[model samples]
Target: DRGAEMEWISQYPHEKEILLPPLVGFQAINTRVERKTLVVELRPSLNLKSPTIEEVIGKLKSSYLTLLDILKGSLQAEALVGPSEERTELHESKAKAAEELGLQRKAHEETNPRWFNNALNYQEASTAAFAIDAKMATKSILAEMKTSGAYTATFGGYQMHKLGLTGL
Candidate 1:
């Protein structure tokens, strides 16, 4: 573990030089290593004229928006597929039951009054509600991050690996 930590620390200068050119003055203000965790505290380089705070802010905002969009799209797609399939099956069963009973049935009326009034309407409402909630949550998180002077960002390791940055 100590060896790994030493290696990581040793590589920091190179990583900073290549990945954080704009943050040329950044320094490790503090560091701590637990059993499996290594935390290196950093602050803006004192020697730098200006830090790229705007770039960091822009990246954060873009990431939040992209995540929200993906979440909303996934929710909408699930709503469209899940409940609609069940509704179709129920509707068909109702039509068959009505025919067996020799009862007149409306062309577009629902078989079960307790079920959703309409599958399309339910799906649309569910999708819209989830999208709105996700948007609100994203807004709240971004606002909090903006207000907080200390911002912590996490990157997906899998994504980095895919991009061939794992060796870095």
Candidate 2:
């Protein structure tokens, strides 16, 4: 039956204990005709103890890394197609995701700077994060393109960096 064939792909880990949030999952329906995709957005259960601000920040960082891995071909092939033609789309999507992650991370930082600082004080440097910033850096790209008349729109807030564009 159609109902029996529906499957949901979880983006974030789901713990029996709640409190942790921003949970997200996607539902996909495959049939003889075409494919259908839906986002299973969940408001965190929020049952567990309130996590310290640092815990949320750490989760955001981990989520970012997980997404980076997803974009870097680290996930199961069946999960994310990562097609060549869809590279740009994937890259752009990741950029937006990363931006959201960064904003959340920054919000945590603002609330608990000391905890955030201490948590990251001992962590290893994120090379891929830095590289993604470099490859996807679009401020200068847009500036140069503007002068060349290649881009006409005024860029406001944009996170245009991604590892998928390294070859390009």
The TM-scores, one per candidate, come to 0.22, 0.21
Clashes of each: 1, 1
For residue 36, give model 1's deviation from the true position in Å: 89
- What tens-digit string does per-residue lDDT give for candidate 1 at 38-108? 99987654345653675443443333334444554443443344455464433343334334222211221
**TM match of model 1 to true structure:** 0.22
User: What lDDT is obtained when candidate 1 is compared to the true structure?
Assistant: 0.43
Q: Write the per-residue lDDT of candidate 2 for residues 1-168, one digit (tens) a residue.
A: 112211234344352322223333224443243347544433323334666556765764555455445444422232244665654544554455456445544444434333324546424224434444444345435544666985565433423443222323
Which residue runs of candidate 1 sit more than 4 Å off their true CA positions? Answer: 1-115, 152-168
Off by over 4 Å in 2: 1-47, 51-125, 138-168
